[model samples]
Target: MRTMMTRRQLLQSIGSGFGMMSFAGLEAASDPLAARQPHFPARAKHVIYLFLNGGPSQVDTFDPKPALTRFHGTSAPSGNLKTERKTGALLKSPFAFRRHGQSGLEFSEIFPKLGACADDLCVIRSMYTERPNHEPSLFMFNCGHVLPGHPSMGSWLTYGLGTFNRNLPGYVVLCPGVPVIGPQLWTSAYLPAIHQGTYLPNNESEPEKLIQHLRNRNLSAEEQRRQLDLLASLNRLHLEREGGDAQLEGRIQSMEVAYRMQSEAMDALDVSREPAAVRARYGDGDFARGCLIARRLVERGVRMVQVYYGNGQPWDNHDDIQIHRRLAATSDAPMAALLQDLKASGLLKETIVLIGGEFGRTPSVEVSGLVRVQNGRDHNNHGFSILMAGGGVKGGLAYGSTDEFGFKAVEKRTHPHDVHATILHLMGMDHTKLTYRHAGRDFRLTDVAGTVVRDIIA
Candidate 1:
């Protein structure tokens, strides 16, 4: 029997005597999602980012500004900081704030469930970003860039450490609907596509609908396995001839993951499998369900899971800041339950949990064309708040502060890049060294500037 070889393969068999070595390298590259070691001992093995989708009001959530209450209906002491829209006098948070837990961490009435777990939270009240618009801010938070082409933090982590479970993706995104910035927020961009986040529109609880084409409808399990074996053989041949094209390699890897997922993903995503008490603890809603799935995925050794609060910037309350109360009601219980469950299961020690939005709302009231909007607040990029828990962070502490009016980050200021750096550091990666060379320059998650806020570290 004679074996036919393509021109590239023929040359590879005879060229430079390094074909075997090159082929070995190609074989390693073929499984880019294979688990790899981190730069050092990792503090956190997994990360769960509970992105609030839109800008949540800092004063109304974690950072309670007593000054706002004192000066209600009066012009802000610092005057109106330029925001996305016109604003009026200071608007106090309607929900009363009370100190909770042994830490005495103040929380608004909207997050009663979270308040019970306040001691476990390290609230950063001085978070700021460069933009106020939804697109740029979302990009900044997710990708560390104001532009759209950078890989997200999840992608960077996946590329750095890969995944523990080959059956599941390294990075998964759960959103009931597309966010304001769409898929760009989770895109891998210049990185291999395999590192990009696998988005699951979790509006539906059924695993089959949540993940389209998850099962082989026509072929039986064994038949599909045989077909996949044949397909992989062909793909490997094409990959060898093409000298390991990244896209082709990624596709091949994706197909294998999809195949393996058919066996386990359904069970992982099925919230009904949990005890009724457990399900009830997390509450009943899409966001709550996503939190549960995040826990399950991380428990199964998935590297990163991001649960976007909702589609189309639900937290962007430019009209009625009261809407934040409603949004918080929907998310607070699940958010708290996630932490409690992780702690109870011992996953909290190794899992990083982050809760925040793109930015925050202005301290002053926003005045639009009508009087009805006077209760709303405009977008404020100067300052905000975010909560971090477990994953080697110092709990029962508030690390930073906004001004008296909650208008600006006055002390221990932090940026999105800093957050990225801190997260990578927790994952045992040096943000400065975790670079991917593209366009003739080595790009990192922190970009040009970011200092890991050591104060927040445990």
Candidate 2:
């Protein structure tokens, strides 16, 4: 009878396909967050995800459907597509779409500021997801699954490449308040706890107030260092006794990060240090501040930074679709400025700026009775739009298309898995090869499926 080989032994013996997965095993013994070599030449070193939580209406945003406008209040074609709630006759966009940039890319008037940077954007209009609900869609988009208990894209990136900055976390999530699934959206899950995203409540502009308990009032720096050293030593001894504990190791690493942050993090989070003209350009609002902070974090070598629009589903406009105008007013300038700022700083070539929501709103008017108003659209998982800029993505382009009625992705259909795969590709990691052994099986960010939308890459 053949003897059973250890997982590591098996992986080493058959090494042709494993590629970076084998390298990852060798690096696991070192500091978990230390920077490591990518599987290949990396186009982007950092990622900034502008998560417009809640389903935003794609027809009103990047995907302009003249058919919906022409057939306004008409019901003959396409019939009713089943979604989370009941919907009525097609509801044309209230806002007008105009061509912008040298490429003549179209954008809604609600985002006039973003329209200025239209040439930098690659809008994907044929994106789809499994569920229409906020919770599952958010989970699918952020964590690559419709269920909880999976490592987020940020977590996966950190696990694959570690981080450039050791003073701060490899992955940082800036949200004024908790979104739908809260920290679970950034959870490390089967990955090491240390790879989980560091949550920062970006409600305050002041660096000190932005991160509470950042500095210890009672202990001096030297004394705190001594205490931390003692604690780390104790933890290491306990770790040796326990064989291995990810949670304990995570706590140890977090303490080291916190100690180092006493200096580096303060300077990184302080946007006021930027020139007044620069700050004014981004405009005012929590999201604007968050965007500015995201640039700052990435500039300081943070591997991934996710800037959520606001607390909860700020874009989930069920009662009235007009709420989008209000939401866009808050985000447009900052988002545009971020793209421009990255470009001006020459970071755009090496940094990715992704602006999107989990899913999108329906094209037809919602009649679900859940809301008092009839103007809003229902949840739509069939088709949506997202903007990807920089990080080697083709600029001034719209890669795919939705149906004429803007009801579904009819051409070059893209999924969240595809987006994740493409992102990992840009960062010099193969989505299929970057695997982590978990629960007696190898797991990946793309789960069991994904195809890198290579056509979208520059």
Candidate 3:
């Protein structure tokens, strides 16, 4: 018996590792690179991650604490929690929180529409990170590693599942510009190039500006077709001779897939085709447009769609927290409408929608004597919050939480690793079992610590 190797296999081997002490320490299951099998029967087939680029303050959004109002401008009741910069005093939330929906979930005044869909959200208020800074936290949030170079969550999903639809990419990421930590978060790392995310910015709206090298102006369709045909023949020959080469086979499949996708993907991108009424509901910003495009792609079988709000550190409200009103307004309605639309169209059952950022803002004020109309908060990886909906997640419930001042997670603390595990679980992939071997050690997305929170699973 002979074993064949291709770029995909080689990279996967590197991902899982052939080295010592790599995969052994992780909490995941034994075999990390056993041909990517499903953990159990899958309840959902796709995922849409509404990545809030800057960390959104949980207190201002999902987790509402009345104590902040009662004790305005004071300390955090003498707790060990510390902010990045020395803070003056605890600032009370200028915005009030209200309970909404049948589940009676609580949300700040900024998100009335999202509050209307509270029952659909599994709000986890106790999510923490290993770092307080933006770069590492962003990397950790998307790649399960504080260090760079690991495969992103999107890349992992694409690698684990080749994709239900070959015409469109398995992993799609939408953002206006470079984000914190740059492309590392969505990178495929050691995975095959095909598994990496297909990034589309706001300018990609038009077919002419969508992808840089995608549409070749130099060659006509017939010419490009001939080039791809020739390349496909060479790749197939290499694959046949190599005997089960993952990379070569993937390339062969990818070229034809790319060719088929040009028109189809462009068509899905054309939101103008949608009714005027539907477009208004999603808002008119570039981010909102991306969200609408995401819906179309997911409907057409794209596996994972991550629509990031704002560019680098927009949510980093260090000086004035009051300004979050603008940020909150940008994300709130479109997210709620997305949930309702998915539910109404029956797509929610098979699609998972998640909203949150790397971490939450600190409870204290940070700017110089600026009147705290809307104060800014520092990064708090100790305990932030995230809102999850659709897919198999039960409607109308909140899971996990932080302490009284919304500083740290006290009960049902859900770490980023746990969230990763749960996301994998929702897609029916066992986090422990999904491994890639790299540098002689087995590598997994969980990186030695993760357990799918069964309670949150519907």
lDDT of 2 by residue, 1-458 (tens): 11123333444465555443322243354567788788899999999999999889999989899988789998938597789998888899999999999989999999998998989999999999999898889999999989999999999898888899878889999999999889999999978788899999898889988888999999999888779877766665565455566678778778878887887899999999999999998989899999999999999899999999999999999879999999999999999999999999999999988999999989999988799999999989999999999999999999899889888999999999999999999999999888888777888889999999999899
- Give me the runs in candidate 2 sitting further than 4 Å from their true place: 1-29
**At residue 233, what lDDT does model 3 achieve?**
51
Evaluate model 3: give its TM-score. Answer: 0.87
Q: Please give the range of 10 consecutive residues that has the lowest summed lDDT in model 1.
A: 1-10
| Per-residue lDDT over 1-458 for candidate 3, one digit per residue giving the tens place of the 0 to 100 score | 01124544543454534323221222023222223446688878889999887888988888887777777787667753665665657777778889888888898999988899988888988888888888888988899999998999988887786566656788888888868877787988877656778788864567446655566668887887778766655654464456655455555555665776766777788888889988888887877887888898889888899988867878888778877898878777788778888989999998989889988987776644543443667778888899888778876778888888888888998888998898889888889888888777888889999988888877
Candidate 2 has what TM-score? 0.93
Q: Of models 2 and 3, which has the larger lDDT? A: 2
- lDDT (CA) per prediction: 0.87, 0.88, 0.78
84: Cα error in model 3, Å: 2.1
Query: By how many angstroms RMSD does model 3 differ from the true structure?
Result: 7.4
Q: How many backbone clashes does candidate 2 have?
A: 0
Q: What would the per-residue lDDT of candidate 1 be over residues 183-277, giving only the tens digit for each residue?
A: 89899888877888999987889888889889888999888877876776677667666675667767766787788899889989888899999
Q: List ranges where model 1 is wrong by over 4 Å.
A: 1-30, 240-244, 370-372
Every model's TM-score: 0.93, 0.93, 0.87
